[model samples]
Target: MTSASVPLSGPRFQTEPAELYRELRRDHGAVVPVSLDGDIPAWLVLGYRELHQVTGDPVLFSRDPDLWNQWPGIPDDWPMLPVIGRKQSSILYTVGERHRVRAAMISDALEAVDPFELRGHAEKFADELIDAVSGKGEADLIGDYAALLPVRVLATLYGFTDEQGPGLVTALNDMLNRTADALAGKQHLAASMGQLLADRKVTPGNDVVSRMLATALALEAEGSGSGFTDEEIVQDLVVMFAAGHQPTADWMGNSLRLMLTDDRFAASLFGGRNSVAEAMNEVLWEATPSQNLVGRWASRDTQLGGRRIRTGDLLILGLQGANSDPQVRTDGSALTGGNSAHFSFGHGAHRCPFPAQEIAEIIARTGIEVVLDRLPDIDLAVPAESLPWRPSPWLRSLTELPVHFAPTPPLEATSA
Candidate 1:
């Protein structure tokens, strides 16, 4: 596998991934053997139907990390352990009937979020974020606004205090930043979640975490819930925390980048509210937040996308690759004008639960709308092509989206 594999790391993965994906498709066809950080081998599923088939049949391509064949070679301290999920007991690793119950609990908890209230929270946080920078004519949208908005909103939804938002952000940044302190940051986040779960147990509120606890209890009362430990609940909360923040933040950042850079959305950035949604949808197709998902293990030897995948083989879902699959998207036309056949949110039973998708949409769209509304005349500070992207194979996100807008007073001074 190492002989034919390409290491899935480089500037190409960041700055010009679509071109890289195209190249991989030409050379490796749909199922490309790729190497992770430690030269560990995995198959990247690049075909649209193949990715669909893999995700759809969870039984065949199981989420259980224990099934991975490379476990013996994986170092205990491997950096990829978190991503590949070594011995994960969370919902992401759950399989079969238990996965269904857990997914339902998560969906119900998120679904109970009041749409109007959710929008209100999004607006509140978005306005606050813009206010922090509105007084300056220049701002890095990624760091100052987009990176900060989703987590703040999510923290509120999950019952974290305004005071705790900064801590959560710090923890998440440290964890994903992949620095020497990454493990410490991850441990801190897990501790915080465990504490929150303990607090919710004592006095549950109308928030997502509390709601999850209540739902679990209700399901157990009805004999519909799988018995899971508080530790597992904490892990699931951490999953929700990580999943909800960065991707949605990138969704906002990427959408804003599109609007600022593309002529089709330039006018829309001013006051055209409708094009905000259009640009966001377009980003999901072209620059999806999640580029690849650390993925399923083959339940048995099987052929996929012309490659023979052996039992216990790891398969990464090449989301952007599948979305841009030439077989399905032959026209070469942009999917911007609301063609959502893209695999951005994934597919099948384990796909992002529909309710979670709605929350992300609300946070992302609302965040983008607030930015455009606040900085009505904003423009990119640097050449669009010169902007650098974060170097991570899993996510397609900008390092910084620098922009200049007319300096204005903070929103609070002008609002009630």
Candidate 2:
């Protein structure tokens, strides 16, 4: 009921912030008031159901990135803004009709895509990845498998070769991991992608890049205002790569760990390849990769959960807290089989613009299926307690998961 804003503590705001989230959930569920850095006062929405409503409501929340400057905790000179075109243009930062148009284009393209078409390709990738790590009996899941796999698939989607995937991964990780130096990496990624777009404009191909180029050209030819320029195209590229990789990688690791650690769930998931679907839902619910509170700024003075927030106040949604809420899954009946309605994919218009949500679900389900079917009783090389966890606020991922497997004949492709 306090109308006043409280200052956020320094230790509370982190690159991969999680500790503060735990505290907020334990202390306040409706709307916990906190400060960021030292002076920025903001309200953290802790419940999952409320978080869903916050993300979905555009009238109450504005997507404008400039509002951060008004907030004390975040630096006004944050480099990622201009470099990623968060200021000039980016569908994620835009609101209303503009967001709608850009989203329409992406949704149309995704609709044209047949997720099943990638089945054989995904299975093959799964096989190759698992096989490469098979003999070693101990592989760093994050460094070796999870981190590398999605980027490779993304590169293929962009019509790039397997060899180019690692470079792209490195560039993206360096940018996101180092928030202070994000601008430099953004420029590097942008320049390279601009060249790729220019080449595609000259001679188109069947890939996401070529498709985006064609879309830009057609929009411009129609005098529909300036479409995505080379830099804007690059921004999307940056988002796709950075957004897609770590989250899914984390999901794979977390999901695998859950099945292994929980006997009942393991029985369901490891029993058959198709059985992983249920376990996937449980893992996603329990350890959502997107653990950070999503950012929003108030468009006007409004009361949330009885607390009055003035116009321009920054707000963050406690995603992790919401997922674990008993109210969201009250009966315990849903997750009785370990199922949950976690907002890992986000909600409403600003949800994942790419087909990443669907793609990740498929990859996680299929990837785990492949491993379980092929190597049924393979124990983790390193014990779960010994596995290292990444200290990231936004992602729940293991640094490495080493596992040892006894030799076994490959299962028939039919089972996969």
Candidate 3:
């Protein structure tokens, strides 16, 4: 079948794509043809083993979008441009020496962050957020809680003020949604980051932004071509902001949904039969927030999962599809404690930095725990099955998570 016949990103996949993935796997084995934006052809890797092979073999399958042979024919205003288009400063779009240099700088800056301290801050933020909504009988968790926690924590870590949090959220959301004014949002975000970088340069602090600036300067002093400019620093910060907050927010929402809807899983956690970590792992395995990853281009003509691949052809890694492969694990159990085999955060040299995972988990777990503790009687305001999902190829986000809980007095009359 041709890619034009398949719809990979739309309302159908948004609400329930698992059945479609299963049918595709059955008909095409591990690798299947799919279309992005309805006409852009690409291969979707669905097998657990096959995804590993492709991500691990950078020589055969490159992460550089510059290698995309179809770029010349595609228009600049393509709907997927924000995702698959190449950016000279983005580590996500680079390969080889460029990737290695930028990745190291980011890794070093992240390693400097103390996980324990970060978790403590996240917990405090969680408590404050809960306090704000505790007095209300109901809330939209996606908006009031899950959505704000991550961005707040990230802003604090990046040395941004509380006043700036809302704009950051708006900019990041617009860019992710690829809205009509996404370009304007990007420009606004860039201007904000540039100003922040300037402020940090004048007055350094213990935040990630300061650390990255230091590293960039050091690389420049060493005469390394990988040295970062102010513009480049701003780009990396944008990446961190988008990558850090969006997935963590979705993960928090997904985990809470599981606890509220799945009796077996919730019982296991509340009955002391399983830990929160176990529940989180299950969410990662079954309903990964970032359902698909973009832009892994073919370095040369090669075969993958028994399918012919030409040089420059794009390959999209179906993360959720691979984790749910029936051949990998049967019965679809959610209580499979602490299994780290899933590709939720990806694998190999290009795997998400360890610091990102640690911070995201701490924020999500702490945020969820605070809500459950403060509002022990929380339940879905509407039937779980009727809940709608945002129609995006990358994220598995609920449009809203309406929930009800017992009314209590706010800890203080302040906005979260």
Deviation in Å, model 1, residue 415 alpha carbon: 3.1
Q: lDDT of each prediction vs. the true structure?
A: 0.88, 0.65, 0.81
What TM-score does prediction 1 earn?
A: 0.96
Ranking by TM-score: 1, 3, 2
Off by over 4 Å in 1: 1-3, 222-225
lDDT of 3 by residue, 1-416 (tens): 33333656766677668887888888778888887773878898999999999889877889878888778778877878767776566777767877778888888887787878888878887887777778878988888888778978888888898789878777777776677878887888888889989999999999888999998998889895768788878988888888988899999998888888887566543434345666678889878998988848899999888888999999998999899988787876653677788989988778888888888888898877777767756789999998878777777778799998888776554343
lDDT of 1 by residue, 1-416 (tens): 12289888888888779999999999889899999988899999989999999999999999998999999998888978767868678899899999998998889889999989999999998898888889889899998988788888888999989899888887887787777877887898999888888999999899989988887777677774466678888899988888888889999999999999989887787777889988889899999999999899999999998788999999999999999999988996676777888888889888998988999999999998888889858999999999988878988999899999999888879875
Instruction: Flag regions of model 2 displaced more than 4 Å.
Output: 1-26, 69-88, 179-188, 268-271, 332-340, 374-376, 407-416
Q: How do all models score by TM-score?
A: 0.96, 0.84, 0.93
Model number with the top TM-score: 1
Error of 1 at 42 (Å): 1.2
Instruction: Tell me which residue pairs clash in candidate 2.
Output: 7-35, 8-35, 8-36, 16-392, 16-393, 17-393, 48-322, 335-338, 335-339, 381-403
Candidate maximizing lDDT: 1
List model 2 lDDT by residue over 202-256, tens digit each: 8888777887777777777888775666766676766666677668777887877
Error of 2 at 95 (Å): 1.8
- Give the worst 10-residue stretch by lDDT in candidate 2: 78-87
